[model samples]
Target: MTDWRSDLELITDAARQAGAVAMQHFRQSPEVWWKNEGRSPVSAADYAANAVLETVLRSARPEYGWLSEETEDTSCRLERETLFVIDPIDGTRAFIAGLDTWCVSVAVVHLGKPVAGVLVAPSLDEEFSASEAGEATRNGVPIRVSRHIAGDHLRLAVAEDLLNRLDPLFVRDVERIKHVPSLAYRLAMIADGRIDGTLVKRNAHDWDLAAADLILERAGGSLVDLAGERLVYNRAKVSHDELCAATNADLPRLLRHLGLGLQG
Candidate 1:
């Protein structure tokens, strides 16, 4: 088997190609379907992109396993040493609504952690990637988390309802940005210093966060559960808790604000 870097090269290209495939159906009114009792939506653009990704990635690394939002899961992948975690078009609603916040998210995991990841947003002309040993990059340029913002001036990206969950003292100190449909892109924004951080609602799956989590980690930040525990992937239980991503300097304050990580 080749090194993880080789897999990074292959998956990054595959993700970009997959983005191209999705863009073709972006605003063409592709078919749509509701899942999880209509609480979630999926579109033909997502499946089209997944097909492109699976063909290219599986062909290049036949020994690896596969898991995707658009494809049925197989217990067989749980037995493999490595697997691909993918969300073909992460923001189906945005894509269907002709918005441009969606992207193709792909990550390779080994031993419960991501070895490499790639996120491609063709419409936005942005591509972000990283490996366990490489710096995070956007469009091939290294990226980093934003500096600490003074109190009362923080720009956070989170659902408005979550704000009410925070301590009123902290809530008054930060400004919330508009909510983004693509959860992956929301995290990516932190990697590029576009936003300070955000709170993730519970029930996010591995495919929704694996790629961008690594990108944010490499760029000097972290995505951790309310307990302030780092996220792990490829587990039998694929869903995550309500998590938050932030730079190291600001994580403690955010965690305290949310009434988490306050005890020893």
Candidate 2:
């Protein structure tokens, strides 16, 4: 098997370059284009960042298939043993609004699992990464999930609608953090101990979760669906429903508290 640490190094550099491309257009109000009938937005910076990332990542591994938010999708990637799964600018809405929450997200996925991943948020000057060979790290320092979350005040970062759906008693205990625009960054926050957890809405694509999933995993945490299944990468259908990331002891309770698996 190929060493995925080398893949991590390559994607880390590529992610930084992509983040730099996005940063060049940040706060400049780059042209916005709508997808999903204006419900989803893309900007010039997104395309520019995608271009830089594609040039670097694809050039380095031509045989490996590619899946990216900005690129045209082909079923070809499903045939490759390994592939690059990426989101050039994960929080395009935040990027457009000049928020520092956006990130250049990339992951090396092998056989429907992420082996190496990199996330670079240039605006916030943060870089997070992980490989199958090692622990998750931020700027070279190992990071682990903090157990303090289960204490008196549980810091939660989630949508209000989702928060409102939780039990009133549970809500009283949570110290809700303001909205984080990037789902990738939100999970990283949990991994690096910025927040305890977040409620992921449905329809999140693989690119949004793969990198952060590995990071959270190595950080002594997990990002799992309502039924407690681990998130997978590079599936034929790339979207996912609600998931939660927290330390192992906290996850099942969270799933129960949120009423996520009650339907079954």
Candidate 3:
């Protein structure tokens, strides 16, 4: 098997290049089109960035299967032992609206688990990366999740409706952060300890979570379902249901408040 560190290096470089491509269209009003029956938007920048990623990554690792948000899905990836999962530009709506929270997310999944991942947000001048065997880093510096124990005011990035679902008394001590349009960057915030945790709505896909999931894990955090199951990538069904991400120490408390059983 190939070294995960090397794979991390590959995807980091690809994400940087892809991010650069996306930046060219940032705030320039690149053409946009809707997909998922107009529920989602895809911009010319997305296709351009996807092209760059496909060219660089596939050329370098021809044998690895490919699964990208901008590319048509194929069953071929499920048959491979490893594959590249990508979101050329995560947070397309934010990107179109001239927000800097967007990023290029890429991950290498081996045997259904992420071994290497990278997220490059050119507008924010940030690059987050990790390998299965190494610590997570942002701009070359190691990062860790926030250590929040009982009695500390929890800082969270969650949708309002989801927040409302939690008992009012349970959330009374919580500090809700403004919504971050980019899910990948939102998870990165948790990984780097910018916030305590977040509740992810259902229907998130592999391209959105795979890369950030690895980064969060290496940074002493986890992204898991209510049942406390860590996600598995490169599956035939790429979409995920409601999930939560937080530091290992705080995950159980957050889950308990959500009325989910303790982390498994």
Candidate 4:
């Protein structure tokens, strides 16, 4: 019988190895390139780390499907019940800029949801992992979300664009805002108590947020679209327009105050 836990362990190790490779090339003044309209950037480190992850993951489980930001989309993944969703070298620009915030992210998606996930940030010396049926952990220690009481100053972490789009009232009341480029690391920060919430808007991709989404949820936090709906994976479209994640229980009121409607 296949040991599902062992498979997760294998992938976790593979993700860390890929993260190490990424850290090696990050901040080395490498070449950067653009894709999909010259707005997004990819560096040599991203490809190098992606190559490592693809090789390690494929060799360990060739039967499993693959979906990665740096790789071409293959519809074959839609047929497999289990697939690897990865964002190797997430935060390429941060990495290139010598920031210690980039990471390698991996998720094992089964039946359209994440069953096991890992986020490795070598430069920051942090690694977060979770299983669908288990608790979230950082460097092997159990982690939980903060229970800050409501009606206090709400912390809202967001992309600069999303911050700019928010109504002035909401923006002024935000206790704090962090301008982090890496989506995965930002959500992980929410899990780590570095931030309280994140509001994401247009052009966010699945690979950018999948692993961290699970990490946040396992830490007693939540990830949802602006409509307060759960985020589903392995969809037909690769990008999302309005997604929000929070570590607070007052998320509904928070969304409403931000001028975004929420659903049940």
lDDT of each: 0.89, 0.88, 0.92, 0.81
User: Which candidate number would show the highest TM-score if scored against the true structure?
Assistant: 3
Q: How would you encode candidate 2's per-residue C-alpha lDDT over 122-156 as one tens digit per residue? A: 98888999998799999889999877623567788
Q: Candidate 4, after superposition: displacement of residue 161 in Å?
A: 6.2
Candidate 3 matches the true fold with a TM-score of 0.96
Query: Order of candidates by lDDT, top first?
Result: 3, 1, 2, 4
Q: Give the per-residue lDDT of model 1 (tens digit) for 1-264.
A: 336788889998999899998988988999999999999999888888999999999999899989898889878889987999999999889999999999999999997889899999999999999999899999999999988644436779867766777677777778799989999999999999988888888899999999999999999999998888998788878898788898877888887776442232
What would the C-alpha RMSD of candidate 3 be, to one decimal place? Answer: 2.3
TM-score of each: 0.95, 0.95, 0.96, 0.91
For lDDT, the strongest prediction is 3
Cα deviation of 16, candidate 4, in Å: 1.2
The order of the candidates by TM-score, greatest first, is: 3, 2, 1, 4
Better of 1 and 3 by TM-score: 3
Pairs that clash in candidate 1: none
* Worst lDDT 10-window in candidate 4: 255-264
lDDT of 1 at 80: 89
